[model samples]
Target: MTSQIELKSGTAMAPADPVLRDFRNFLFLVWKHLNLPEPTDVQYDLAAYLQKGPKRSVIEAFRGVGKSWVTSAFVCWLLLNNPQLNIMVVSAAKDRADAFSTFTKRLIAEMPILEHLKPGKGQRDSNIAFDVGPAGASQSPSVKSVGITGQLTGSRADVIIADDVESLNNAMTSTMRDLLSERIKEFDAVLKPGGRVIYLGTPQTEMSIYNRLPERGYEIRIWPARIPADPDKYQGRLAPFVMRMIQDGKGPGTPVDPKRFHDLDLLEREASYGRSGFALQFMLDTSLSDQDRYPLKFRDLMVTSLDPRMAPVKLMWASDPDKRLDIPMVGLQGDAYHRPMWMAPEMAEYTGCVMAIDPSGRGKDETAYAIVKHLNGWLYVVASGGFKDGYGEATLKGLALLAKQHGANKIIVEANFGDGMFTQLLKPVVSRIHAVEIEEVKHNQQKERRICDTLEPVMNQHRLVFDQAVIEHDHKGTSEPIRQLMYQMSRITRDRGSLAKDDRLDVLAMAVGYWAESMARDTDKAHEEHLESLRDKAYEDFIELVHRNTNSGYEIDEPSWLN
Candidate 1:
C-alpha cells in the first residue's frame, strides 16, 4: 500500500520546484521512490556535506555504508536540479567508475520527476559517459566516468568525484601509492575553477591520500560504522580517532543503521575478520588494522602479569640469564654467536645490566629508556618507560634515579640528534644524584631494521621477558607514551609506513645491542676469573702435598731444598 502522498504511476512528468530548491527533499524523494532504507544520521550528514559540493569533501565511511550509492544519487540529484552542470566520476578501476555513472544513468531514466533530465538518444548515452539534453552553454559532457589511473588528458568536469580511488590490490605498495597520488593531481588541471571535489573511500594505509586532503583546504568528513567513544575527544571525523574509539571501547555499541548492522551482526563480523580486519573494514581504523606487518606480536612476547614491584623475582630462569647474557646459545642463525635464551629460574645469577636512552627532549616526541639484565646466555628486561617532558632538571634527575634503582652498570645514549647533548646533559643530573657510567653510541643501521634484526632473533627463541607494566598497557592512541610504544612495537612496518616516530623501539634496541656487547665482555671476565681460581687452587694443593710429605718424615724434600 503506497502512501497517499506518493507519486502515482504514469503521472505526467513535472519538475518538483520545491525539491529542486532543497537537496534534502530531493534525497528524500530519491529514497522514497528507490525503496531504500531511511537515511541514518551519517547518511544525512553525507547529504549535507555533498550539498556544499564543488569544494572538497571526502566521505571516509565504512564498507557497505552506501557511500557509493549515496554519491551516485547525489550525482543524479545534481544533474536533475541543474541540467547545465557537468559532473565526472572516477574510481580505482574503470569498472568501479562505470558503476557510478551507470547508477546515475539509471536514476535519471527511472525517476519520473526528472523525466526532463533524461539523456537524449541521439545526443549522448552510454554507461561510461552521458550527456543530459545536449551541450549548449558548457560543451563538457554532463556526466563522464574514468579510472584514476586511466587516460583523461582531454576530459573536463565542473564537479569531479573520486570514489573508492584506492584498493588493497592496486595501492598496496609504495610504488603503486605514489603513482595513484601523482595521477590524482591531474584532477586539478581538469576541474573547472570553483568546482566541487568529492572523495569517497576507506583509507587502506596510515599514510592515506585522504589524510592529506585537509592540508590542501579540502574539508574531510569520516563517518565510521560506530560512534566514536570519547565523543568530545574524537569527533568521528578521522580514522585515527576511530582507532582510538575502538581501542578504548568507545564505539560499535550502536551502528549507523541498526537493521543492517545489529549487535550480533557486528560481533559476527568481528569474529570473522579478527581485530585487524574488522577495524579496517568496519571501524575505518587504518592505524589499528595492520598486525601482520610487524615482526612481533603480543602473544609471542613472554610476559608475567604479576607486577614486578610487588613480586620481585617471582619468575626466574636457570643460569640467571636475567643478569648475564653470555649463557651459550646452542642454535643461532648467521654468525652463530651464543645468544642466551632466558628461562624461569630453576637456578642462575645474572651478571650484567645496562640502560639505553633515546632523549627526544620534548616537542611532542617521547623521551624513552629501557633497562635490560643479562645472564650467561640469557637476557631479561628490567624496566621500560618514556616521558614527554623536555630535558629539564626534573626529567633528567628522575631518569638518573631510575637508572640507579635498576642497578644498571652502563647507560648507552643515542647520540644522533644533538651529538651527545642528551648524554652530556644527563651527566650533570647523574653527578648530583648518583654517578653512573654512561657511554654515547651512534647507530649506523636504521632504527626499524636494527630493531627487527636484533630483537627478532632474541624474541623468536623466546628469550626476552617483559614486565607487567609494559605488557598491560591499553595501547589506546590517546593514552600517550605507553600506548604509543605498544602501537609502534606491534604496528611498525618494514616500510616504516605506519608510525611517525619510534623512540621506545629505538631505546630498547640500543639496550639490546649494549647487552650483546656485554655478553662478550662478561664471558672474557668469567674466563679470567676461572683461570685465576684454578691457579690458586693448584698452588694450595701443592703446598698441602709438601706439608703432608714433610709431616710423613720423608727426606726427599731435603734434596730439593739443597739443590
Candidate 2:
C-alpha cells in the first residue's frame, strides 16, 4: 500500500496508509501527483489553517492564491481521515460549487491513495452529490454541491465548505448583502452538532460578509498578496503567521509568496484591476480610506447659497479649515463639504439652467430630479430630490414645479428606463406648468462608470458646486441616507450596483453632464481673464477722468509721469 514518489535526486517514500493524518502532507502529495511544483509557504499555511483552525472559520486569501485548490485537497484529506463525514460545498453559483466538488471527486478518483474512498456501486456518484465507499447510509450524500440560494434547507452536513460565496454579483448592494448574510445563517441550521464550516473567499466590498463573520464567532484569517504598508487597515485580521512576518521586518510591496506571484506579476495585475480593485481582490484591504476607490468627495464640492438665475462671475474653491462648511455630511471619513474661498462682488445672470430627471417605476427606486445652473465654467446644483410617486400626476407636477421654481429652461430625462415614455408623460404636465423643453437622453455605458466619468473630473476641478440649501434639503429629503444624493455621490465606486439607490446621483450626473463642454475652460485661465478685464476697466476709467478734467474736449495723450 506504500506509495513511492520518484524525485530527480532520489526516491521519496510517501505514507503507506491512505490517511496521511496531516493535511499539509496530503496537499503536497496532491500537488506532486498533479506534476505541480512543491507547495509554497502560503499554500502550506492555508493547509494548516484548514486542518487546525477553529471549527467555524474563514480563509480570506488573495485571489489566485490557490486557496480553493488547497481546500479541495483538504477535503480529500478530511474524507480519508473520516469517511462517514458528510460535507457540503456552497458558492455564489451552482456551477462554482459543482466545480469545487468535481475537483474533489476527481482527486479521490485519480489519486492512487484516495482510490479507496471512491463511490462504489449503487451509491450516488454525480458531481452535484456523491457518497464515499465507506460512508454509512444517510439522508444527505457524503459530498454535496449547492448554490447559496439553492435548496439548502433540509440538507444536513457534518462539514460545509463555502467557496467564493460572496461575489460582486451577489453582494453588490445592501439588500443583496443582507440576503447573503441571512442565507449563510442557514449553515447553522444545516450543520450538525460540533460540525465545522469553512469559508474561502476574497472580499468583494468593504461590507463583505467575510469581514463580519468574526462577530458571529467564526475566526477569520486573511493573507494579502503583498505585505501591507498600512497593516492597521486589516485591523489585526491578517493570519497570525503573516502578522509575525510583518513584525519581522517584512516590508510592504514584498510578495508574501514570490514563488507563485512575483512583484512584476502583481504589478501587472494591479494595473489591470486598477488600484482600488487590486486592493480588494489582491491586497485584501477593504478600508474605504482609499481615495481612488470612491472618486467623488464632498470636500471637492463648493457649498453655498446658489441663486437660481444669478451667480458670482468668479468663484474659487479651497479645502482649508476656514472654507469647510459645518453641514450634515454622510460621506466617507475626513470628507466634508467646503465653501468657495472667494466669490466676486458683482453677480451676473446664469448663462443657462438645466434639469435632469432619472425616472423610475414604482419600487424601491426613486424618480429623482436635479436642477443645475451654469455660469463662467462653473456648474451649480440649486435643487435636487426624488419622488416616490413614479410617473403619476403628483410626481410630474412636482418635477414641473421644481423646474419652474429653479428657473430651469431645459429638462433632460433619462431614456433608459421607460424608453422616452417618462419624458412623454412629463411633457404635457410641464407644458401646463413650466413650458420647459424636455429632452430624452440615453446612456450606453455602465451606470456606475458613466456617473463616475461624468462627475469625477468636474468635481475634481471644484467646478461642481452644491447649493447649501440643496445639501440641507437632501439630508432632510430621505429618511434613508443611501437614497440621498450626497450619500450616493460619495459612496459610489466604479463597480456596478455599488450603490443600492443611484437615482439621485444619476440625475445629478446627467445635469452636470449637460455642462460638460463648458467645463473644459481652465479655472486659472478664467481668473487671468478676469484680472485682465479689471485692468482694462481701470485704465478706461482713468482716461475718462483725465478727459473730464481737461479744458480741451479732445483725447489726452499719455503722460510720461503716468507711464
Candidate 3:
C-alpha cells in the first residue's frame, strides 16, 4: 500500500458509530486505545454531511488535502452503522482500486474499538480480509472490495465510490473514453433509485467523466481554490497547500527537464498531443474543432488493421517528372488511421482491385500517375513512382506488365501532349497487353483547379487515407501540394494569381473522378430493368418500319459517319 499520513491536530473528533452507546465505544478506541488525534476541518465537514440521508456526492479538490483519509473515515462510518449494506469501490486502474481497498482494511484493523469485530481474518494467507464473531455477526456490513473488470461485474452496491479516474500517465483515448462511458451506464442501470454515487478525483481533462456527468443532470458543486476573492488586497493565499503539493510533485525538475509533473502528481507535460491533458484536467475545456480535419491531428491521417492476421499492400499511381533523385520514388506502408495489415498475394482476392495510370511527356521534373483502390470503405494508396524518362512506348510497356501482374484492368493516359504521338506510342503496347484496357483522355483546363473541385467531397467524407511519410515527404514537414489545395479551397472564386502547382493533388483528383464515375455506373445499373422495357419498345418500332417497306424492298442506307 502507498504510504498515507494522518494529521494529528489534537482536537476531539466525532466517533465513527452514530448511536450513543456504539459511538462511546468507538471514541474510546480512537482516543484511549489507538491514541489517535482529532479530525481536520475537511474531515469534520464530510462526517457531518454523511450523517444525512444516503445521498452520494463527489469531492473535487487539489492534491495532498487528505482526501483519501477523509473518504476512508466516511466508508468506516457507513460499514459500522449498516453492516449488511454493500459498497462498490473503483479507481482509474485495477492497482489503484486494490490500494484503496487495502488501506481501508488497515484502518479497520488498527482501530482498537472495532478490533473485536475481527474485520481481517478470512484469508488463508495473512490479513487481506477480516471476519467477525463466528462468521455470522449480528452487526457487519459484509463489505467486499474488487476491481472494475469484466462488464460492470463489481458495480452493484448501495454505494459506489470512484477515486482519481484520469491519470496523465494513463491518459484517456477515444476507446478508453468509450469504456468509461459504458461503465457509467452500468452504474445507472444497477444503482438502486435514491442510492448514492460518490465521485472523488482531481480534474484532469475537460471532457472528463467528472465534468460530463453534470450535463446529464447530476447536481454539481464546485470547490475552487477560494470561495471569494478581492483583487485589490489579494495575495493569492487561497489553495496554498494544494499549490505547494503540486510543486512538490514536480520533484525538483526544471522546465527543460522532459519529465515534469503537473497538478494531482498525475498530469504530465503536453507536447505533440496538443493541449489535451491540460485542457481536460486543470483548465477544464472541451475541444471545439473537428478532430478529423484538425491541422495537427496526426491520427486523423492514420488507418489501422482490424484483424491481426490480414496484411494490406499499398498501391499508388501518380505522375512525377524528377524521378532522378535517389529516393524520389519511395512508397511507405504503415498505420495511418487503422492498424496496418500486410497484404500478401493470397489476400488480394479480398483486397485486390484495379489501378489507373496517367503518363507524362518530359518525365523531366518527374513522371506522374494516379492510383486508387478501396479497402474496408476507404480508398488507400497502392503504388506511385516518378522517373526522369517518363512513360512513352517502352516505359508504358513495363507499366502495363506490372499492372497486369497486380490484376489491374484499366490504364487511363492523358493525351494532351499530342494525341497523334500518344496513340502511335501506345498502339504497340496496347496490342501486346491483353489483360488491361488502355484509354486516352484529353484535358484543356488547369489541372489543379479541376482536381480540387472533384476531390472536395471525398476529403469531407474522409473517404481517402494517404501515407503520412509520403504526404510529409519533403524536408519542411509540409506537403506543398496539399497546402496549395487548401489555399485554393479558401477562395470561393478563382479570381487571382496563378495557383500553386499541385502534382500529388492532381493524382488524388483523378482517383476521386474515377470513384465518382464508378458510383454513377452503379446508379445506372440500378435502373437497368426500366431500360430493358424501353429496349423492347424500340425493337417493336423498328419491326413496324421494316414491314411498311416490305413490298418494295426499300433501299437501306448505313449511317453517314459509318459510311
Candidate 4:
C-alpha cells in the first residue's frame, strides 16, 4: 500500500526517502540522481555559505559555464529539505529568470526520489510559491522565482539569486543602459535583512552592477578563463571551473587536465570569435574586451598652443571616405606645458591665415570649414555649419567668404567625392573660389587600421590637439569619438585586424590626417607671423625683467649681453 506523502509543490514523495529528507542531503542526493559529479572548491564554498566571508557567499561566474544549473539545484535543496527556510530566485532578465525556474522544475522531475516535491505549476512561471515540506512539519518552506525587473516593491525574499544583472551585448546603447540601471536599483531594495544575495554575470563594464556589486558589500569572484598562465599554453579555465562544479554535485572523479577542461578544438575551429568567446566567457572581464565602449583615458595629441602669441601654425582640412564636414581638425602651436590659446579679439588684428574645409554635400550632417591663423599660437576653427539643402554649394560659398574674410593663402579640398561639383556648381556662382589641386587616391587599409597606423606616432609625439569646442560639444560628441579612438589605439594587430568599436573614430582620424598634411606644407607664412608676434611681446617682457633686475640689484648685462 502506497501512502500519499505530499511535498511542498504537491507531488507525493511516496515511500519517504530519507536522503530527500533534508536540504543539504537532498542537494547531494539529487546531484547523484542527475548523474552530475561532486562539487569543486567554488561549489563547496557556495554550498556551505549563508554567512559573510571574504569570498562572496554570493558569487558571479561568466556565461556558458552552467551557473544556472548549480544555483537552481541549490535553491531547491534549501527549500524542500528545510521546513522553516524559504528561498527566492531572481534573474536580471525575464529569460534568465525563466531559465532558473525551469531548471528547478526539471531537477524535481528527473529525480523520482524528489519528484514528490514538484510544484504542480508550470515551469518558468514566476511569483508562484510552493508549500514544500513533509506534512505535519509545523511549518513549510516556500520557493519562489521572479524577474528582478518585475514589481518587487512589497515583496520579500530569504535567499535571492540575481543572474546576469546587465545585458552584455547591448550595454553601450543608451536605451539599454537606462533599463539596466533600474534593474540594479530595484534588486538592491528587494532582499530581506540577513537575507543573502548571490549575483552572477560577466563583468561587462566598470559601471555595471556585477562590477559594482562590491560597493554594495557583496563579495566578488572573478574567473578569467581563456587567459593562459603563459601565452603559449592556450588552454582556458572554463574547463576547470566546470569540472569543479560538476565534481561538487557528485564526487571528485579523475582530476581534469586544466588545459583539457575547456574544449580548445571547439573554440579553435571557430577562429574569428576565438578571442571574444574566450575572453568574455572564460575570463569574465568585460571591460577588456568590449571594444565599442568609450575609453575613459585621455590621449595627448599636441603639446603646443593655438595662439599666435605662443606659436603660429598652418592649418589643413582632411576629408575622409564619408566626406564628413564639421569634424574637428586639431593643430599644435606651442610647447606641451603652455598649451595653445585662442587668439583674443584684440590679438586677432595681427593674424593672417589660410582656411581648409571638409565638404559634405546634400546630407543630413553638417559641413565643416575652418579658418586658421598663426598668432602667438595656433588658432583654427574659423566657422562650421550644415549645408543649405544639404548641398555643397553652400559650403563652397561659405569657404569663399571665409577665405576672403580671413585672408587665407590657400584652400585644400579633396576632390575625390563629388568635390568637383563645387567648381562647376559653386565657382560659377561665387568669385575667387576654385577646387584646390590634389589628386584623389585610394588605399588598401581599412579605416580602423589606417587610423591606428598613422595616428599612433602623432598621438605618442603629442603633435595633435583636439579642439576643446568640438570634443566637448555634447555627450554624443565627447563619448562617441573618444570611444572609437581608443579602439584604434589598442589595435588587436595579432588577431588579424579587429578592434572593439570604431565607427565615429574614422572621422577623428580624418582630422588627424588633415593636421599632418598641413604641418608638412611651407611654414614660411606661419613662421613669419610667429616671429612678428614674438618680437612685439618680447619687448614688454624684457622691460619687466630689466626693471625687476635693477630693483633687486641682480646684475643686468643689458647692452652688456648681446649689445
In the range 13-129, model 1's lDDT, one tens digit per residue, is 344455355566567667877888766655666776788643877877877768788788888777766677888888998998998899888887887876667776576788888
**lDDT top scorer:** 2
TM-scores of all candidate predictions against the true structure: 0.54, 0.71, 0.39, 0.51
Q: Against the unseen true structure, what C-alpha lDDT does each candidate score?
A: 0.67, 0.86, 0.45, 0.47
Stretches of model 4 off by over 4 angstroms after superposition: 1-27, 40-42, 45-58, 62-64, 81-86, 109-141, 205-208, 226-272, 287-297, 300-308, 312-462, 466-563
The TM-score that candidate 4 achieves is 0.51
Question: Which ten contiguous residues of candidate 2 have the minimum total lDDT?
Answer: 1-10
Q: After superposition, how far is residue 481 of candidate 1 from its true place, in Å?
A: 25
* Every candidate's CA RMSD: 14.8, 7.0, 21.0, 12.6
In candidate 4, position 15 carries an lDDT of 37
Q: Using TM-score as the measure, which candidate wins?
A: 2
lDDT for model 4: 0.47
Q: Candidate 1: which stretches are off by over 4 Å?
A: 1-8, 11-16, 134-139, 230-252, 290-563
